[model samples]
Target: MAPEQGTGSRSGCGGKGRGRGKHLPGACWDTLWGDHSPPHFPSGQVVKLELLEQVQAQLRDVLDKAMEEAAQSYLQPHRKDPPTQHPSPPHSSGLLEVEHFRTFYHIFIAMLCVFILSTVAVDVINQGSLDLDFDLFIFAFGCLPTVLATWLVMFLYTLLVPYKALQLWAGSYHTVRFPRLFTAILLEALLACHAAVLGYYPIYTVIQHQLPAASRFIVILKQVSFLMKSHSFLLEAVPGIIHAKPPDGEMKLPALSTYLYFLFSPATDQLPSPRTPYVRWKYVAQNFAKFLGCLFYSYFILECLCIPVFTNMSKQPFSIKTLVLSIFNATLPGTFLLLLSFFAFLQCWLNAFAEMLRFADRTFYKDWWNSTSFATYYRTWNVVVHDWLCYYVYQDLFWLFRGRSRVAAMLSVFIMSAIVHEYVITLCFGFFYPVNCSPSLPSSEVSAGIQVCLYCQEWYAQIHCPLEQKTFWGLVTPRSWSCRS
Candidate 1:
């Protein structure tokens, strides 16, 4: 054969036999494989066509077999691309709106914050920042101002403003009184300062190394009951009773001696009955005993329900501080209850009796108790101190001009009340926030100053502070005397 024909014959694969794909025309075959089996150049040249053809045929057969095996293995009847799972709807972030937060979650969040803050406080204290001695000093002086400031802010925000708004909204009064807002805040600070008085015993104990375990009830009771002076229950009940003649004859004043004896007696008959404040000595004694019995039973019930858990789990020291704090925690739920009793029951009864006396005499507001308006009420409601205002202040001003002027009396009363209130509050506040820093600063002066300033610094560190310690201590102790109480 001719050299090119020989190359073509050697390179022929199955003699260009038919297959599934398109046919290779004679002209194309001669150009692609006849003379150039291994894809030779356009320039004529002989090449190894047969060996190339054989390799190409083998490769084709192997590829075909491999592809068939791959299809059989991968292409099963149930197989699918992982269903292109649309990503799960993005999870909600739990963000709440301001109104929703206020309506549903503010109190919960506040309680949680209180819990967290309390834990942080306990940690700081147990960690012993500034050591024990310095801790007391900070409690007495340094922490005072911050406590006062916080109290002032809280009172203003929680009490006075809300009260005034409520009163205005109620429409019982014709006008809104907005004098001495600053003085109100000052009073709250002063009230908060009184809490420091509790620190005295605790500080003394810490100094004497007498800080007892919180498990010791005896120590705790002595400290907490410091304010519960021995009194004739009859005596306390008598003043209000003697001072309060019930409107109805059926409601006779309770027996004085029985009430007094009950104050000291361990028997159930010592406490006054809500149902019968007017009973004579015999019935009053029996009822008082019942009241005491009930109280004791209730106390035991509560103890059974709570004390075991508290005593067993508590890790606090039973210092004076702890006792006071425990009392505070215990009493907090009932704070408004006591306030209501004082105002609604006690004040109302006393005022009603005063009115009855006036009615018997056929005189109106002339009785020492009645006042025409809010301004007048302030003067008459606290008469003993008001007498000083009338005599020392209002009277003096009137005498200076030789007459009784209602305007002068009003101004004098308002100003005096404001100043006295301001003075007490400012003194407490000054202790909470120091004004002048110098070697000349004295303790009495510092105490006196805080008693008067009535403002506290915001950035003051709660760590190594007295008031902060007391607040934490209050949570674990027996009795906490707070502002409103």
Candidate 2:
């Protein structure tokens, strides 16, 4: 971006130059324009005509970019929930299917075994017999009946309300008497209703039933998931259906089966075309096993870290120093629990569910562990939620502003994510603590500011959405996790 050396040398029109004590503006002007005093022309010559033309060209470029984004966001005939950072269809593969990194899969399994054995060893040394107690686990997963009923109620509302409203509105949108006005009113009404219901329903149910930790997680997680999925469906479907130019007069509605599938499918985003059915029974079984292994691994990890510490704590009085030391001690186990959560939910559970569906995409997550920058981590980590945020929230808002101020869009994404995270914790723990949201909101904005330029618009041109092989930072887990801890 530096100017030419000749231009720079000629253009130092100031009281002081680099070596020369002073330079006159006339000298620099003449050097740049090749005239001591340029001859004036009519107002319409350069000032009016050329400036107008340049302004028009710039406006046209902005307009064209805006239209392109609108078409992608609103006019795509398909593409309900495509993966993140992919313009066209993305190249997706299983986590363990990478060429040179199969060892990671084995390493996870070995870690699982190690944790299990260590848990057994500790029990034997203490009780003189290998015995595993799951009172805490049972407590965590208690109240399953109420959890299931609550999920069903929320699911039914999401399944029917948004889809039906969108379907009816789209069918009559073109033929309506006042299309834009009516559509605006309808949208606001639906959104308000949705907000009122989904906003308070999960918290109400959790408080009413006093559900346990894991049980409450299911409810809160589903609430967030369904809210996102419903928004995505409406965002994607409404524009495409309304904009369709069919030879026949009547408009087509999305199939109920497809909509139902989207509700149950592992991927939150919609795709342009459906994936072919693959009955990978063995793969499903293996992933379920891994999911269970992650749970047991987490349990043992908690026990290994907590049992001795709690025993010691019971023998001593609580104090500021003790609390600080306890936090420091929990750091490593907290890290293990977080990683195990990722493995359990994103890698194992999503993959298993997708495979069980017989026709679902398996790119639930990516090599997020290898991400060097927070921006890449945001895109690669937990791609299911990230895809919904990127597509329905970030891209929607980004394009709404005509691709200007991506920082706003990125911040909106993190804010939405933080709200859901805080909401889940508040409802699950029966306390409204913004601990998760407090640091993350500011950190995400700061990260967004620093990382605004790291992402490119044409990132989808690559085959696999790969990151630069970072030697050091790639190995570091996200600092945001530690802040929450």
> Which prediction has the highest TM-score against the true structure?
2
lDDT of 1 by residue, 355-409 (tens): 3222111111122223344556544343334544554456657777567576876
Q: For residues 1-485, write the lDDT of model 2, one tens digit per residue.
A: 11224554444433342222112234444554664445555554545545544664577578879988997888657646644442211344465667555686677678778878887787899899988668779988999888888888888888888878987787677777998998999899898878777778777888788888789889888888888788888777876777776556556777878888888888787775346434566777998998888787777765676555644543343355654565566556665666677778887787677666754456777777677666686687777788777777788799998998889888888887877776676566543334454333222333322221111111111112223563445223222222211
lDDT for 399 in candidate 1 is: 73
**Which 10-residue span in candidate 2 carries the lowest summed lDDT?**
453-462
Worst 10 residues of 1 by lDDT: 455-464
The Cα error of candidate 2 at residue 420, in Å, is: 2.1
Give me the runs in candidate 2 sitting further than 4 Å from their true place: 1-93, 98-108, 121-130, 244-248, 310-324, 432-485
What is the TM-score (0 to 1) of candidate 2?
Answer: 0.66
Error of 2 at 444 (Å): 16
Model 2 residue 199 lDDT score: 73
Best by lDDT: 2
